[model samples]
Structures are given as C-alpha cells and as structure tokens.
Target: MNNLNYGIIGNCQSAALISEKGSIDWCCLPIFDSASVFAKLLDDKKGGSLSFKLTDDYRISQEYLWQTNILSTTYDNGVDAFQVIDFMPRYQQKDGSYYTPPDIIRFIRLLKGKPQFSIQYDPRLEYGSSKVFTTIEEEYIYSQTKDGKYDSLFLYSDLNYEDIVNQKTITLTSNAYLLVSYHEKLSQQSIDRCYLKFQRTKTYWMDWSEKTTSYPIYQNEIIRSALTLKVLSYEKSGAVLAAATTSLPETIGEVRNWDYRFCWIRDASMVIKVIADLGHPLSARKFLQFVIDTIPDKDEKIQIMYGINGERDLTESFLDHLDGYKNSKPVRIGNAAYIQKQNDIYGILMEVIYRQFVEFETTLENREELWTIIKGITKIVEEH
Candidate 1:
C-alpha cells in the first residue's frame, strides 16, 4: 500500500517530503509554488526521486531530532549500520535577518561496521515535463532541463559522482555529506561548512521551540504542531501556505485534489489566530502584514486564496502526464478556487484583525491602515 508515511523538512521558503525509507518523493525548489524538483509522490513512474538504496537485510527506522525539524533515518543490518540525516538550512544571520536557503542537506554517518548503500539521484525537472540533463563538474553536479521551460538544480557531495550517477554501491567508511541546491553557490561547498550549517539550524529550531509557550498538557504535541505551522510560514512575504502540495486526491479515485501551496485569507487568518494563541506573535504579525500587502486597495475584492508572495491570480491547470497519487488521474497545478468568493472571509479577517488590535500595540500609521481595512471590511459585509 502507498502510504503517506513521510516526514517533512523545510526552511520555510520550500519544503520536501521524505518517505520513511529516506526517499525525497515530493519537493519544489526556490519557492513553494515552483515546479517540482523531485516528485515521485505524484507519479511513481515519471516523477523522479533522490533516495538511498539499501539491501533487503537492512532494517530502516525514521524520526525527527528532538525539538528540531531535522529528520534522521537509520539503516541497520545486524553487522552494519548507518544513518542519513536530512535537513534544510534555516537560521538567523548576524544582521538579525534569517538565512533560509532553498537547499536540502543529507549527512551520512557510519554508525557501526562498514555499511553499504547506493545513491539514486534521478531528478525530473519542471513537474516531470522536461528531460533533465546532468553534468558532473569539479565543484558540483549540475542538472538542468534540456527542453521546454528552463530549470536547474545542483548537487554537491564528497561521494563519488560517477558512483552516484551509475548507482554503484558505496561502502561507508566515515561521515559524508550531500547538498542539494536550487541556486549555484559562490562559496566553496565542503563537509565542514555542512556540519556548521547543521549545528546552526539545530540550534535555531531548539531556540524557536523554547520560545513557544508550552502547556502543562500536550506540551510535546503543541511544540510539534507549532513547529509545523512555523515551517509553513514564508519568510520573504510573511504568507502562510495552506499546504505544500498540489493534486493529491482526498479519497481514492476522486478529483477533489487542488493546489494548496498558496495562502487563503480564511485559512491564513485562522492560522494567525492559532499562532498568536500559542505565543508566537511574530508569525501572526507577519501574516497580518501579508494580508495588508495582498489587498492594498481598500475597495478591492478579496481573493479566496493568493500565492505565497501575495500573487492575486491563481490559475488552475492539469499536469496530464503525471499518473497522480495511486493512479488518480488529472493531476493539477494552481488553484481555481482563488476566483471563488467566500462571504465568511471578511468576518474571519475581522476576527484576526480584532485579536491583533487587542493583544498588541501598533504604530500610528499601521493602526490607521488597519482601521481603514476594518472600515472596508465592514462596508463590504454590509453591502452583501
């Protein structure tokens, strides 16, 4: 059975879902709404993935590192064992700004005797629509689309590039690192730099978790849930995504699938409220700012949803090539529901706005703008 047993890792700008066996089945690069770099979760055949191939005797186990979004998957076969630590770098830079890159790092460590594995580094560019051409360079392995719309990715690693591309078995003697990036790096990629990033990212998440107000009951669950909401938040635009994927059927053999990588006013407003209640005011405030930025004109008609960067138009379309999840057909991208008018959104936004006003003080300019927004919502509500 194809199960949704995947742990997520992200730096807020983009996220990827790695299966329990350490396969990155779904990922979109550079941004949440970009065409997928790895998407085996949608189509088993056409959609590509990056995974570690282990022998039948190997026993696999997966878990998130405590208080952090980093995922650890271990493979053991009695005599030999190793772990694959997956994480996307996200930490605060020296200038008090966040350094959240669209990069996924896989750190491989030998736990016991010489463990063996093979790297399956296939990547389908532009939602599996284009043929990808990979070239190994001294600095990194670059893969780009050969035809159609232009897209690319880079893989930097200490492992043998020929062995990785040819699927040759590699005996793990020591720790190694694989870094996947959407953009080419100017600085030299090395194992020591990877370790530093991992440590910084780990510290970032732990500190973030520590800041979230914990209840005596369900404290662990609350932290996990809060962490999930945090990762869904886009740092650049302050938009919170409804979900990271598109075209996954709600039920078997149904067409209810829709792209949720965008932000819905109703959904985001509610999320802001929940986040505020959890004592994460920054996220809540940022989302409010996103709302203001999205609808600059007071009289403008509100969209049901908008892109992560506050894009108004969300034109829905199909990726007919993809087989969809579990043979479900007509895989879709974008969301047509953006055009649909929801009457309750005004009230929802009002609630969030009211909560923000009550709990926090704002500058006079912001307060005036928010009051103007309130008046606008009131007028719209009364009109309809």
Candidate 2:
C-alpha cells in the first residue's frame, strides 16, 4: 500500500492518494502541502488511514474512467466481482462557476456478484498525532480533532451503521455511496445527490479531455500525464505543486526526501509551457498570472517558491511525532529552499515571458514598465 503506483484524485483545493487496495493512505486537507490528514504513506501503524477493501481475496486493477481523473478500481475472484468508484466533487455549474466542494465521494457498484467489505475510519490530525474523536448518528458520522489544523472531518454513508470508533464488516450487493467532507461537519449535498454529482464529474472531466486532448501518437500516455498535472494544479490561484506526498524518501533508510508542497517559480514556469503544448493554453495563462501576482515590489528579492495563494515565509519544520518515510527520520513540512539564494530563476522566468509573447497573442501591457522590471532582475543575476 505504500508503493508509488497509488491512484490519485483531486479537485483543485486538495488531493488524496489512495492505494490500489482501496485505502486512502495519503491525503492533505485545505491544500496539497498542508498537514496530511491521512499519513499511512509515511508510517503504516500511527499514520491515519480509511479503508474500503473487499472481504474476499481477489485481484485488483485500477485506471482512470475514460480520460478523467475519476478512478475505477475493480476486484474479481472468478465468480464474484465489484468495483469502487473514487472521485472528488467537481463539476461545472450552470452559472459559469464551479461546484467543487471539499469532499471525497466513493461509490460501490456490484458488477458481477455480492461483495463484502471491511470498514476502518481512523483520522489522525496534525500529521498523525491528534486522534480524531467521532460521534455516530443515525445516518451520518461526525469527527472532531484539535481546533487549529483540520478541526472537523465527517463521513456520511447510506449504509446502516451504529458505531464510529469500532465498526464491523459491511456487505453490499447493490449501489452504495460515502461522502467525506473536510470543511463542513455535514455535507451540503445529500448522499443520493452525491451519486448524480459523480456522473456529472465523469462527464465534466471527459468533456475537458475531449476538448483539450488531441494527440495523434502516444495519445493515452499524453492524456494520462496531462490529467495528473491537472489534478496537481490548484485551480483557485493557478499554482501547481511538485508532488502530493511529502517526506517520501527515494531510498529506504536514507533521509533524502524533501517537502515538495510549495510551488516553485522555475518549475511552474516550465509546467505552464508543457500544459500549453498539451492544448490547455488557458491553464498556462493562469499560471503565468500567478507568477505575475507573486512579484514583490517591496522586498529586495523575489521568492523562489510560494504558497498557492502567494504566501511567503515557507519555513521548514519537522514532524517529530511520526517517523519519516521508511524510518528515514526528519519528516519535513515547509520547504527551506525559500530562504536560500536561487539566482537562475530570472532566466527561467524570462524564458516563460518570451513564451508568453510567442505562444499567446497577449497585448503587452505597460511595455516600458515591464522592461524596467526585467532589466532590474537581469542586473541582479549578472551581479551575482
């Protein structure tokens, strides 16, 4: 379950990486780089995990649903088979806005025969230290942890349930759904309504793919990679992260893993070009806007990386409670590179600025002022 081939689902604000076994092992709330609510990817014992695995032993396979980020996991044991549909709530509203609530939706569909599943709803907050307390209701379950970082997380299921802390095995032969939310204790959308949103989510993603994905050769590879990038992007501000999980070491027993939750300017600038080449020019343009908004007129130097909302001071910190990936130790949160001197970013960003002129027909607003800023930055690079 700790391997790298886990499927990922996101809706701009946050992301969740679920293992092929249908366990949500790594997920950060509010945003991608925030403290992980489920950290089983780092430490299996103390790390938080929510399980939805089949009772019967079977072979499992997972893939995206027809050019979408929505994942479909199938389990088959010759006679009996079932599938788990996983996706975040995201679809275009009729008012030209998006209805992307902070919720994770899972639909269990009986494909061939009856399937039974074991349920484990354990949520450890503040990087797997603060255990979440639960209150089980007639139809829904409410859980609360410490106040500051991720206070309330709830799960509403259509299945008949009584206990929250300790739960027994549940069997399902028909369609069922579970909606887990981070912000609100109760979901604004009902459990049945979540089913409709799942359909619309598939439609919305496929429609986006149909419009944006157009490659003659190596089409599947290109589309899947593009979809991964799309899920990693923060839609509200157009910032893109390097990866989802933090402190995952390259080699076991080696503390080589660094936090990659922040959006680096040099990396994002290149990603914008790649996204544009893949046919989503709008996304590239939005990332450029994010870069422009990060320009600090007052500070003496520009930050190499920032939060999705243009936050600075990315002071790195270690989580002492949980051991590092594979016991590498020193599991870090924020990136310390923000305080270092990164000089090559000017040329990298200038390359993107040149791309803006070539790829986009954007009118150069305040040409003289723009040149003045560029010249200033170039001078700094030369001086260094």
Candidate 3:
C-alpha cells in the first residue's frame, strides 16, 4: 500500500484511526474491548468514522518511532507539507494511585508553507449499530449516546461543520499547531485535569520506554507488540482484549465471526504467561487478582469469558440493518459462547493458578477449594 498519511490515536483502552488528512476513520469506545463506535474500516455506511482530509489532493506515508508506540504520519499536498503525531498516554501506578485517561490525542504541525484541511467528526455508536446524538460546541463537537454511558467524539481544531454534514474545514499556516482530544463525560475541572494528565502520561511512556530492558532480537518489533498488548489491557481490571475490534472477520465473508470485546479466559492465561516471560511479574499478578475477583464463589463452573470489568450476561444479537464487513453476513454483538459449557475451563484455570504459584513464589490460599474440585473430578473420572 502506498503510505497514506494517517496515524492512530489510542487511549490504551480504545483507539481511533486518523488520516494525515485529519479524518478519524476508526474508533472503538468505552473500552478497548468494546465494539466499534466508528467502524468505517468495516462498512462505510453503517460503520461510522471521523475523517480529516485535505480538499486538495494529498500524498501520505506513516510509521511509528523506533521502540515507541508514537505514530507519525506525513502529508504532502504537492506544494505544502504537514505531519501528525499520534499517541495514547500510558497510565502510571504510584503512591497507590493510577494516572491515566480515556482520551486520545492528535498533535498536528505544519512542516512547510500552508495547507487547507477538512475535518469530519461522525461517530457511529455500538458497532455502527446506533446513531449518535451530536451537539455542536464552540470549539469542539460533542457526540454522546442516548443512554449516556459512553461519551465520545470531541474534535479540537479550527474547523466548523458545514451544512449539518458533521464536518469542518480549516486552513493551516506554516508552524501552526492543533491538538484534538476525545473523551467521555468530563467536568470542566476534569477536562483541565486531563489536559495536564496528558503531559504526565507522555512522560510516563517515554520514561518507561527508556527503562525497557533489551531483548535478544527484533527489539523494535517486540517493543511495539508489547505496547500494543499493553494498550489492549484494561488498567482498571488488568484484563486484556483479544483485539481492538470485534466482527472484523478472521476470514472475511465467513460465518466464523465472533464478538471479541470480552475477556477470554484462554487469552488471559496466554497474557499472563507472556507478561511473566517478559519479566513483568506485577502485571501478571494484577491479572491474576482480576480473575480471582471476578470469579464467583457460588458456582464452580467457570465462565469462558467476561466483560472487561468482569461483567456477566452479555446477550448476543445481530445488527441486521447494517451490512457486515465486506458483506460477510450478520454483524453480531455480545457473545453467545459464554453460555456454552466448556469442560476444559476448570482445567485451564487450575493450571494457570498452579503456574502463577510456581512462577511468583506464592501460595494458593484456596488450595482446599481447588483440591475439593479436583477430587470431585477424579471421582467422576473413575466412575466413568
């Protein structure tokens, strides 16, 4: 693909795709594991996106800085040039408090001469399954859902929506700068706090990245992958998403589509091992704690998946109106597989707990419970 001037802005939970032209084509909201709010990547009509493109023809190329998750995209409109720097601030845990935000930042700068840019802030909520309520503000466009659970779509730039199209256009002079931030409901104080928090987040990422130990090989790729993995993690619960998107089609046009917005016990185990292997024991421990906290005591039958914050009862449904990705078929939401009885889950959980004990030099306080379950399993096996 010819390098398109586009980059990604993420909140370490969810992310948005920003073209060098200043358009947001993709963004999943509430959490990284949530369904797409702007899914133009899947279906253009049903899948909504925020797009910024130049009225004039532009050439673009994109790349990430070495060993860093920061994305840089360059745009050339023949005579003029500009660049966009995109990154999500990493959260930090210190003094028993975590510093982070559910925000995405886009920093735009003019590299040469002047360029005209157009911005479009169109958000399709619930995997493009729901229309968003748009409120045009003086400096930003506030898009919220009716239920008001997920607050999204704040565009910061010198642009105005034209003719109710939910788009804006701006002219950039040399050395001009623009910062666009997206977040959920935030008070005036919180918004100010978040702007400051953004700086601290940048520092945290840069510092943490500097302290990263060397890997044997593929160091740069490893760092990028590690960051991507971290970005997918739910800091509040330590659960990681399988991917940022759901129903993207593992195989386009196949029925193999599955909702991946929830935490999979299987993936959790793998994540623990990966983090441990990477010498981050604290992350693994937090993940274990999250699992322990989420698992119910009444039922020995462990669920195969849970919401990012350990929510249960995710009902599966289809958006029949919106066409599927590449017209694959029914676009599904929620997850039906949770109700299925997977016998191996118990075994997997037990194995993971056992491995954690060994690797972390810790003891299992619930050994009796585990032993009882194991004994029951053994009795059943013998009877069979």
Among the numbered candidates, top TM-score falls to 1
Show the colliding residue pairs in model 2.
Answer: none
Residue-wise C-alpha lDDT for candidate 3, range 1-384, written one tens digit per residue:
133234555655666666555556667655665656677766778777655566547887778755556667778877888876666656566776664454556566678878777655567776665558887675556666776355556654443345235344566664332333446334442334434555666666656555555688887776676666666677778787776655666676787777776788777777767766666676676676677667636344557788888888879888776677677767777889888765555555566666666666444564444445555545544555
| Pairs that collide, model 3 | 3-60, 5-20, 5-60, 13-32, 21-52, 22-52, 23-51, 23-52, 24-50, 24-51
What TM-score against the true fold does each predicted structure earn?
0.98, 0.92, 0.80
Question: Candidate 2 lDDT, tens digit per residue, 1-384?
Answer: 255678999987788988888888888876777677789888888888887655556888888888999988888877777788999978898898887877788887788877666678887777876767788865567777755555777788777656325666676667887777776554354556878988898988888787675778988888888888888889888899888878888787787778888788888877777887777888876777776667636235778888888889888878887787678777888888888777767777787666666766554663333455577677787778
User: What are the root-mean-square deviations of the candidates from the true structure over C-alphas?
Assistant: 1.1, 2.5, 4.4
Q: Where is the poorest 10-residue window by lDDT in model 1?
A: 360-369
Model 3 CA deviation exceeding 4 Å by range: 1-9, 17-23, 33-35, 55-57, 93-96, 130-133, 144-153, 158-169, 174-199, 210-213, 341-351, 361-384
Q: Give candidate 1 regions above 4 Å deviation.
A: none
Best by lDDT: 1
lDDT of 1 at 308: 92
Q: List the global CA lDDT of all models.
A: 0.90, 0.77, 0.63
- Model 3 Cα displacement at 5 (Å)? 13
Residue 313 local lDDT, model 2: 83
| Residues 11-116 of candidate 1: C-alpha lDDT, one tens digit per residue | 9999999999999999999988999999999998899999999889999999999989999999999999999999999999989988988999999888999998
